[model samples]
Target: MAVEMEEKPVIKLAAICGSLRKASYNRGLLRAAMKMCRDSVIEGIEMEDIDISELPMMNVDLESNGTFPLVVEEFRHKIRGCDAVFFASPEYNYSLTPLLKNAIDWASRPPNAWADKPAAIVSVEGSGKSGQYHLRQIGVFLDIHFINKPELFLNAFEPPKKFDDNGDLIDEETRKRLQDVLLALRAFTLRLMKGKSY
Candidate 1:
């Protein structure tokens, strides 16, 4: 009998965190999502090198200068190279964070990195619904095929500190919800990669 090795799907995921706060709930949500999906069909991306804050505003004139900002180029490249994107956002004053929005603004120019890509949103904050709605608005203009089900809205302010310094999901229920979302997102990406429309 011959032993055969299983092949893993080459799923490149670009995770963007909306908040730049040192202890942002949104970043923690991404961490939770990655941990929960370790055994799933898709691989989670840890974009630790990219700085969302350094991408500057959406200025075409500035972009047309001598050189493009490394952060902007890297962000667009990540989105273009990846099969899907997972946005970990926080609702600040009932809207998406500025840090994440600016990064998206820069990436959605000229070539539009998010044009027709499969994407998912996760928000961990006091009001999860608010974050979700706000993020949806951005999804509309970017032309991102946002996932409609298995939403992960972690209520961090309620009970059980669901994250620590490194943004790890501490609660069991929250982890389960993140896992469910990842599973759905994995299937979503795979289907999209296979040329299937959702």
Candidate 2:
């Protein structure tokens, strides 16, 4: 006799890369994750790279009558729809990239789009390590619950080149570590959904 198996609910993830460069290592990490999901290597989750390049500099003047610009609204909508977030960013001058902060500000307006969402960060750092930490501080006020284990901070300049000319992550060890972080995020998100944090 055939038996029926219960299916798990799919977790929707919105991925954001701080750098806007086409050949950014941070961006490559996000793409690799999406591929993992497509290949079933990471099951029960769907991730979409949400582009914030179109958002203008955040300003209250832009919000008249409690309405934001079209691009800002769209970005906030994406954040609101996601069950969790996957942030791939590189620290700049002991802080996060301006591109990322601007996007966060826009979504953090009158209605907080990131409130209570589980999120994770995969950063590529070379000595200056304040970027991800700064992001974490921001998350506290935004109410974004970030997982506290298996942080993947890649040193792109280290031996065994992590990426090729295309900026694709080719290092097996890095991929494995990144996978671990993603799995952690998935588990944390599930716990949040079930209202159990253990």
Candidate 3:
């Protein structure tokens, strides 16, 4: 009898935070998500943070001159290399933050690196319902396949129930939900890769 070996498929996921602040609640949510994926037994799924704060605002003239900044190139490269993406956005004035929109615009230029990639968004703020709605509407035009269920909205201002003094996610329920989101993202990415409808 021959021994059989099983191989696990590796899924690469890129994550970005909409807020540039070092102590941003949205960034903390992404950290929690990364931790959940790291501690999971889901096997072969890896997530990395892509810093978008360094990207400059979109300028058509610069692009037309073939002078896309190094940061923009790196951002696009990460998106192109990843199997999926996770966006942790913070709502500002009932819409997505400028940082997140700028990053998205850079990735959607010309070749459109975001097209056909599986993505999920988790909004962390006082009120995220509006931001999530706006992001979804924009996502439709970007052609990114987003997992619609298990939509995560964490109220950072809810106090002692969810975040700590340092703004890290500490609630057990919210942690479980973050894990669920990661698992769902992995499953959906695999389904899309196999040309199956999720």
TM-score, every prediction? 0.83, 0.95, 0.91
Estimate the overall C-alpha local distance difference test score of candidate 2. Answer: 0.92
Q: Best-fitting candidate, measured by lDDT?
A: 2
- Which is better, 2 or 3, measured by lDDT? 2
Best by TM-score: 2
Writing each residue's lDDT as its tens digit, candidate 2 over 1-77 gives: 99989667899999999998889999999999999987989999999989999899988988989889898999999
Clashes of each: 0, 0, 0
> What's the candidate order when arranged by decreasing lDDT?
2, 3, 1
RMSD (CA, Å), each prediction? 3.5, 2.1, 2.5
Per-residue error at 145 for model 1, in Å? 0.6
Q: Write the per-residue lDDT of candidate 1 for residues 78-124, one digit (tens) a residue.
A: 78887788888878888877787788888788788888888788887
